[model samples]
Each structure stands twice: as C-alpha cells, then as structure tokens.
Target: MRSLRRTASTLALLGLLAIAGCGSGSGSDASTAAGGAEGVPAVLNFSAPLVGGGEFSGAAMAGRPVAFWFWAPT
Candidate 1:
C-alpha cells in the first residue's frame, strides 16, 4: 500500500511539473516597448567589452538585423 502511495505521489508530482513547465507563448513581457526581441534593444544604454580589445556598443547595433552565435561546453 505504501509503494502504491509513493507511485501515485510521483505521478502527481510529474503531472504538476509538466503543467508548470508549459508557457503561454504570448511573447509579451519578452519584448521591449518597440516590440523588438532577442538582442534588439528599444533604448541605447548598454555596452560590453570585446574579447580581444576595445568595447562593443549597443547603440551601434540598434535598429539593424544581425546574427548572433552562442557557444557552450556540454
């Protein structure tokens, strides 16, 4: 009976997790005031240091289409 209870609790927890993991997919908060997403900033007030030298500016990349590449070690 205890094993059956544990199995039921595990199933219940999995169902809860699955439901919670689902997103609404509306894409509202993820956008800026100009409705731009993914590295498209509505305002120009950010910058970052380059890997080699100098610094990159966000103002330079605003209102333009660019390709972004990401690398990760798994």
Candidate 2:
C-alpha cells in the first residue's frame, strides 16, 4: 500500500539520521592520551565521590569501558 511504503521510507530515513548522529566527531582520538597508559583514554582521569564514603576514580578502570547510572533528588 502507499501508506505502508511511506511509513517504511520515513522509518528508514530516521534510522539513518540516528546512526549518523551517533558517529564520532572530528576531535582528538580518545583511545590515546599524553600522560595516560597506552591505549587508555584521558576521560579515565576522573574522580567522583561515592555515595557511602571514599571516592571513585576512573583511572582505576583504565582501558575498560565505563558506564554510569546517576540518580539525583528532584
């Protein structure tokens, strides 16, 4: 049907746009840093306070993928 074809085309175009938006930008490569270990990103050089006590340092997890789950009071 014409309606089905139009819907499919719109979905395809949106998918392509989403993929393009996720692509890396023309910036410095994150896999290499001047003062960091080889293959480690400068983004790993961060420190954040833990909920209980102490601190969390991203440097402790260098060369590994990091995921954050942040919850703030509304």
Best by lDDT: 2
lDDT of 2 by residue, 18-38 (tens): 997797775446675588666
lDDT of candidate 1 at residue 47, scale 0 to 100: 65
Model 2 stretches astray by more than 4 angstroms:
1-31, 36-39
> Cα lDDT of all candidates, in order?
0.64, 0.76
Report the lDDT tens digits of candidate 1 across residue range 1-74.
99999999999999998996797764333334354445555554456777676987665766564555534448
lDDT of 1 at 34: 59
Q: Candidate 1, which segments miss by more than 4 Å at Cα?
A: 25-74
